[model samples]
Target: MIDNEMSIEELEQDFWGEPSFSSYVVTTCHKARQKPIKDLSYEEIRCLIGQKIGLRFVLSVAIDILQANPLIDVIYYEGDLLLAVLRLDLDDWKYNQDELKTFISILQENRSKIENFEEVSNELVNKYLQIRL
Candidate 1:
């Protein structure tokens, strides 16, 4: 479990030790966001996990930004990794143009945070795998 108190340095050490993890996470998120999940190969599950981890981190940061700025309201967050990646069979949350713009801007501004989150998530997953082995 990652707490908000965790610093970027900790996350970077955990997640960014290797370059592949960061690349994979970013690529996965971009691809998943554009395509339907049903079309993705089964082998891409790890990528989906990366997307989820990154998105969750982005959302957390976005929420914090909203709290501080109060510029826009975030009505819904797509929590389902499969649905979010595939963009299938999900509820449509309406957002005003300004709200949507602000949300995108916030996410873009905090791109580094998402990457750091991915690093942390990957580190934890790796640890879990080591334990299982």
Candidate 2:
């Protein structure tokens, strides 16, 4: 069980194994916010994916924030692969293989419209918030 008192930094260190990766994830998220994700180079996307660390960091922070504030419904990653990390307890919801395939298809079809992480997240929320399995 995670302590409620733990800071995001502490959680990152404990869950992700390095505090520095948290900084990197934040910096990358900032950049994503400032620019279009579609404009980012493959290398930049690769860096944000960061051998798994970046996505994990982003998901961890998103989970922490959503636990306190449920208004936000999703966190997304649009890179070499696209993923929608829903802000719900794992016990409450889990996507089935068909749903996962549908999401991936939707992502691929709407690639041009999703210009940033926010767009990716919003797309998922708009499409999948009511879906459960």
Candidate 3:
């Protein structure tokens, strides 16, 4: 669990090991104007799972972004795999027939990064599988 004393920046640095997407603005829904959950360390957020104290920062960011564009039909994430279904229809031409294209774009752009992430997740999954077996 994240120590309640630490600031959001501190948690982001601890977990992601990089500068958070936004360091200055508070992103959470809290009335006190606290930073969003993205700043929380993975372990910290995981600890608060039952309480639902905050949104999953990474998931929220991605979903919000996708929702804004209006191209995605649906986005289902199974662990690290972001399975997206594009809504392609002639009536809604502006946002149609591009789901596959957008998916490909996301895959191409983030392939290397996601590949590494999946490798780690796969190892963990395999470990669990072996235990079950």
lDDT string, candidate 3, 2-103, tens digits: 344544444445332333454322222221114444454433332232223332233333333443432222212332123212111223223222433444
Number of clashing residue pairs in every model? 2, 0, 3
The candidates, ranked best first by lDDT, are: 2, 1, 3
Per-residue alpha-carbon lDDT of candidate 1 for residues 27-100, written as tens digits (9 for 90 to 100): 55455434333343332433443344333323334333443532222222322221232221111113223333
TM-score of each: 0.24, 0.23, 0.23
Model 2 residue 94 lDDT score: 34
Candidate 3 residues lying further than 4 Å off, grouped into runs, are 1-81, 84-96, 119-133
lDDT, model 3: 0.34
State the lDDT of candidate 2 residue by residue for 32-130, as single tens digits: 433333344333344444434334233333333333433333233332233324322333223234433454345445545554455346645445534
Report lDDT (CA) for all predictions.
0.35, 0.40, 0.34
Candidate 2 positional error at 107, Å: 18
Output the worst ten-in-a-row residue range by lDDT, candidate 3.
83-92
